[model samples]
Target: MKEITSTMAGTVLNILVNVGQDVSIGQEVIILESMKMEIPVESQISGKVRGIKMKIGDFVNEGDVLIVLE
Candidate 1:
């Protein structure tokens, strides 16, 4: 399994994929709101989404795990 992690501290603005969804590398998975700016989190591997670790409006810190792919 591969872990998708946040690159910076932010609030989870949106989740674009659900569990069991197939995703490719570089695809947008989630959107983050930090410092009054929006940033997108991308999928790091091409695989089926196994787990979603956070929810919308959840606060995420840098290096926090967001998703799992298998």
Candidate 2:
């Protein structure tokens, strides 16, 4: 399994994919609002989404796991 992590401390603005969703490497998976900017969290590897570790509006820190892909 591959872990998708937050790039910065922020509130999760949105989750673009769901469990079992197929994703490609570099595909945008989540949007985070931090420092008044929108940062996209992307998949690092092509795989199916196995779990979502966060929800919209949830606060997350840098390096926190956001999704699991397998």
Candidate 3:
């Protein structure tokens, strides 16, 4: 199993992948907006997305789990 986590504190701007979707390493899974800048969170491991931990417009902290994969 693998997890995609937020790299910094921010509001969720977008979710690029859906549950049951395949993802590759370095693929953007979520976009977060902080300080007017958009930061894309990428998957470090390739796998099928199993879950999404947050929704658009939700605040997330660094290291928060964004997507679960297996």
Each candidate: RMSD to true structure? 0.6, 0.8, 0.6
Tens-place lDDT per residue, model 2, 1-70, is 8988988899999999999899999899999999899999878878899999989999999999999989
Per-candidate TM equals 0.96, 0.94, 0.96
lDDT of each: 0.95, 0.92, 0.93
lDDT (10s digit) by residue, model 1, range 1-70? 8999998999999999999999999999999999999999988789999999999999999999999999
Candidate 3, superposed: residue stretches over 4 Å from native: none
Clashing pairs in 1: none
Q: Which portions of model 1 miss their true places by more than 4 Å? A: none
Worst 10 residues of 3 by lDDT: 1-10
Top model by lDDT, which number? 1
Query: Model 3 residue 26 lDDT?
Result: 90
lDDT digits (tens) for residues 1-70 of candidate 3: 7888889999999999999999999998899999999999888899999999899999999999999999
